[model samples]
Structure formats: structure tokens, C-alpha cells
Target: MSRAQEHPAPDPAELGLTSDCGSCFGLCCVALPFAASSDFAVDKEAGRPCRNLQDDFRCGIHADLRQRGFSGCTVFDCFGAGQKVSQVTFGGQDWRRAPGTAREMFEAFPVMRQLHELLWYLAEALALPDARPVHAGLRGALDATERLTRGTAQELAALDMPAHRGEVNALLLRTSELVRAEVPGKKKDRRGADLFGARLKGAALRGANLRGACLIAADLQGADLRSADLIGADLRDADLRGADLTGSIFLTQSQLNAAKGDAATRLPAALSRPAHW
Candidate 1:
């Protein structure tokens, strides 16, 4: 699990952004597809239950997943979509019990997942102090997004998530600008830089724009990255110990999942410190 904490201690307001595996019906294990690669021991098709998935919707080898070559499962976080689908959308119905409804249920899982992910981002954006300028809009968007989550399965499957995301992204970008402006000095616009394996340890990157940057295996230990814009930044294997990410924009759990960090890595409240640190 990248040595990240086996379990995440999430913030109270960010509850919907965290996983509640116990309340879920193992939707991810059943609805997601995995290829036979370094992350998985065998290939599995979408909607097919994993061999290790227990009858009770738990991983049979949860504690031994890594040793059993199921590391890919460890990195995935459905952001509370699983339970919302299983308990709320499907009314606690398991796919096994209602085989006829399996296809729609499986398809709606991804759709609701995307919607819930947007809620996660929107909730975080609304809480940012610098985002006060657009709180009303963010709140409206949050309400709308939350409403979508409660829609019928067909409505979610037909949802134009890209359109909704576009609207929310515009507000998030504004929030980023406002937060970065708090720091004096011209923000470095390094969006989409190919910094693969770059050694940037302890670098002064506060308020830097690293949107979509390729930072694979980069050494960024102890770097000052407060208010940095990290939208879509590829942070796989990047060393982030002791780095400060306060007010950093658009940093997702998935990005953090792919990176290496320690206890000293200061993260924004929306994200948690990985246990591996």
C-alpha cells in the first residue's frame, strides 16, 4: 500500500471523501477490471468478482494482498461511492442476490464514483479560506452534485459528468489563484513540465504551478510547496518527506497514493498523511 497508513484517519467534514469499506458491498472488487501486471497476479474482467473476494464482500486475503500480488487493490479508493450505491442506490441489495440487476448496478458504480469524486473536490474547495470569494457558487455546485448522487441509477448512468466537472474546475482554478496569491512573489508557472526523475529536494516551490507535470521519481524532500497547484501532476514515486503542501491545489488521494511520503510531509487538511511515512 505504498507504506501509506493501512487505514486513513480522515477529517470530519471530509467524511464523504473517505472510504467506508465496511458499509460497502465490495463494489470495487466486483465492478472494476484489472490487467495482469506488476500490480495484480491475474487479469479480471469488469463485473467479475475477484478470486480473493470473500462471500461476505470482504477481501479474503486482505492482510496478505501485497504478498499475494494484489497491490493494485490497495491503491484504489472509491471515495464513499461503494456504500452509497450498495446501501442507498441499491437499497442494501447485493449483486449476488439480484443477479438480474447486476449489469445496471455495476455500470452505475463508476458513474456514481465520478460524481462522488467531484463532491470530494468541491467540498474541499468550499472549505478553503481563500475560496471565500466563490463560496456561494461552490455551495451551489456542491448541492447540485449531492443531488446527483441521490438520483436513480439510470439518471447517474446518463449523467454528463464532464460538463459538471468543467463548471467545478473553473471555480477550483480560481480558488487556486486566490490561495497562491497569499504568498508573496510571482508564482512559477511550470505547468506540464517533464520533470521525470528530477532532483528537486528542499526546493523552494511555494505557489508553483505544476499542473500535469511529470514528477515521477523526483526528489522533492523537504520542499516548500505551500499553495502550489498540483492538478493532474504525476507524482508517482516522488519523495515528499517533510514537504509542506498546505493550501496546495487539486491534489488527489490517487496522486498521493502513487507517491512516497513520510510523517514529516505536511499535507492540506483535505488529504491525509500516508502511513508509510
Candidate 2:
């Protein structure tokens, strides 16, 4: 059966205007592994079911994961990857029915998740009034990322995600530099500056405007971003292992959805970590 028939049509609100997690097979919880931590407090391997996941694949502690000591569950967002992989990509062939497909499905989940995340950002960039100058480029990139998501299972399975991510990184970097350039004293203003690969461990950026900053590969292990404006920051490969982004304004879902960070990565209450991360 096709995904549409098996999973049913998605509601806009559930998908977060991009991808929905409810229409998924709990792919993130099943396909990805997690270790014991203050966030999770348990160890699970890839393709294994999370202890909190019930027989129907719903989180057993859905209503009280935080109070139940599974604080990690409170901060996870799949960016719609779970539904895309379970329904559209695999055509609703679940792991239980086709156990042999588990490995491939697990591998494909993260790959497609990253592509969908890029789509999210590209879509957001197009909607930005200040990013008018880069609209054409953003649209082009968005189209390319969207097309990539439509690749066949074989093609997606063999994709070199790191390399593809690098290509997209370049375009995102250009967009950031172009948009932030319009601000006065662009060089002097650290707000929204490209800090890719810069060593900023333990640095202070309280109340600073970091909108559209490119933080790819930057060392932000303990930097403070509280109350900072992180509207369009590029955090791909950025080491925000312990960086705090509480109260940051204009920090969109697409930004966190695309970036790579761990449980130690502190986020605004509005956003959460990707379940598969």
C-alpha cells in the first residue's frame, strides 16, 4: 500500500507546518540508539525500542516524561523524519512486518531527516523579508534539497550525507554573509556573525544579536546565548555540546532541526532536540 493509504493524510498543525511526528512509526525512538544520561537515563541500541515506548508505539509517559525522569523525551523533535521514512519513503512497510528492511530504514531515516531539515531552512529563508537579496539563491537551494528528498531508496541509502551537507553549508554561509552585510558596522557588530570553526569555548554572548550567524564547526562548548537573537543561525556541525540558548528570540524550528547537537545542547523551551540525535 502507498504511504497515503497506510498512514492517512497529515494535519498541518501536527506536522508543525513541515513534517508531522504522529503519522510516523516512532522511527526515531526505534531506529536510533541512546545511552544513559541525565537526559535519557537508559541505554538502547539502533533499531531497538525505547523502554518508554508502549506496545502501540506511543510514548508511555507522553503526559509526564519530564516528571517520570525521562527529561530527554521532553526535548526531542524529529523534524518530520519519522513520518517521512515510515510512510512516504518506505510506503508503510513497517519494521515488524518486514524485519529485513530495518537496517536500511534506520540508515535512511537520518539521511532524509537532514534533507527535510534543509528544506525547512530554505523555506524559512524564502519567507524572510530581509533575505530578499538571496531569495533566488534560497529558492534554488530549496528546490535542490526538495529534489534530493525524493531520491529512490537505493540512491538515498548510498548518499554521502556529510558531503551533501557540506555543499548546502556553503550556500547557507553565503546567504548569512549577504543578509548580515546590510547591517551598519557589519564587521564590528558581532551579532549574526559567521563563527564557523572559531574557538569560542566559554565565551559570553548574553543579549547579543546572533541572528543568521553561521556557527558551523565552531567550538561553542560553553558559550552563553541566553536572550540572544538567534533567528537564522546556521548550527550545522557546530559544537554546542553545552551552549545555552535559553530565551533566544526568533530562533526558528528549522534552525534547530537542521543543526547537530547533543543532549548537553541547551535550547529554548520552545524547541527540542531531534529524537534521533
Candidate 3:
């Protein structure tokens, strides 16, 4: 089977609260640049491996990252971006083996990282029952994003990422506005509501609590889900083309498999699409 076929892409549904890191190659520890802060306690440059990264590409302090002053590592989620770049885009070759490919690989890493971030948000947008009015648009956006993720290295390299990001940002802003506009009072609980197949075009859902909600087949085009809590939500076949999910919480693999997200849809850490798709 082709690589893509070998990795059954995850659906953004059936999120039973589990993190899936099977698709990753520990790229975040090596490919990303970090500065010492509350999140991370050291300084590292892009393309340089983290001091805590083990030979097998796992974290040497995996069990005690936070205590070891790598708290940021614990919170940082690549949304499967590392795996896609390491295994799919580079055809399973690492920077060490293909030393010449390092520059390109490093360059592509951040681009894919941003796209995966968007997928996470789109997944969360589809789970909100209140944003049921724009489901169709959301699905369309999801498909578009998926295609972008599968583009060739040259395509990704040449991409005007800022322009593309701007387009997605517009949609996420709208999603946030729509979702939060309806609450009569500031203190409303819309957690775990069933919003399968709802239309939520251009909705804004920032900082919303949607834990354990059912959002299968929902439309979430151009939705904003920044900082939303989406633990254990179902998102099977939901649309999320132009959604933004940056800083969203607790998203998992089971949720992604149930939903229909594309390259443009941002995703959280720990999950990735099947390379074949």
C-alpha cells in the first residue's frame, strides 16, 4: 500500500479523550525554535534537536518534562504536523540520514505546523451545537485545507503562507462571532451539546466550553475556535475548511476520524491524517 493508504487519515469525530502520536517523528523537539520562558526553560534554534530528545526521537524526560523545566514541551502540540513532514512530505526520511534535505525539511516544518494548527480549530468549530447555521461552508473549507496539506514540497515552499493564513483567519473570526453572539448572559453553559450537521458559517467560538459535545457532520466554514475546550467531542464528517483552532484544548484522534477535515482545517497536537489520503 502507498504511504497515504498505510496511514488511515483520522476523522474529527469519536473523540473519546485520547492523544494519538503514532504519526509523529518527534520533529517538534528538533525542528522548532524555542526561547526560555514560562513554557520552556531553555533556548533552542530551529533545526537543532532539543537536548532532551532521545536517540529514538522520543523525549528523554518524557515522564518529567515539566519538572525538568521543559513545561512548554508538555503543552506544545504540533497537531500531527511533525509526522506529516517527517513521514509523508519527506517520504519517511529524517534530517540525519538525508543531511542535504535538512534546509528544505526545516523550511517546510513551520509551514505544515501552521496548517495543522488550523485543522485543530476547524474540528472544534464543528462540535458546537449553537453554531448549527453554517455547516455546509465549514465542510467546504475543510476539504480545501486537506488538499493544501498534501501539496508537494515545492508547492509548500512556494506558497504565500501569510496570504493563505489571512484567508483562514477571516473565517475563524466569523465562527467566533456567531457562536458567542447568542448567549443571553455572559455565564452560559453550552458544553457537550449535540450540534451534528449544524450550519455555522463565519462564527466566533473563542474561549467556549464544548466538552463532550456531539458535532458529527456539522458545517463550520470560516469558524474561530481559539482557546476553546473540546475534550471528548465527536466531529465525524463535519466541515471545517476555513476554521481556526489555535489554542483549543483537549482535542483527540477519535474525534478527528469521525469528522471530515481537509488540509486547511487546523488540528490539535497528537493526531494526523492517513498519508495515503
Best by TM-score: 1
lDDT, each prediction: 0.83, 0.68, 0.67
Per-candidate TM-scores read: 0.89, 0.66, 0.61
Worst 10 residues of 2 by lDDT: 7-16
For every candidate structure, what is the RMSD over all alpha carbons to the true structure, in angstroms?
A: 6.4, 9.3, 13.3
Candidate 2 residue pairs that clash? 15-20, 75-273
In model 1, the Cα lDDT at residue 189 comes to 85
Could you give candidate 2's per-residue lDDT for residues 57-176 as a string of tens digits? 688888887567676565556667778778878888887778888888888988888787666556545544555666666667766776777676788988888887777656655555
Query: Where is the poorest 10-residue window by lDDT in model 1?
Result: 2-11
Model 2 misplacement above 4 A: 1-19, 186-250, 254-277
Angstrom error at residue 175, model 2: 1.9
lDDT of 3 by residue, 1-277 (tens): 9433553333543321123455556677877899997558899998898888876777778888767777556545566777788777899887777788888888887888777766666655655545456544555566677678788777889988888767765665566556656544453245779887888766777667676678777887778776566765676556767677765655655455545556777765545652212
Can you give the lDDT of residue 117 in candidate 2?
67
Best by lDDT: 1
Assess candidate 3 and give its lDDT: 0.67
Say which prediction, candidate 1 or candidate 3, comes out ahead on lDDT. Answer: 1
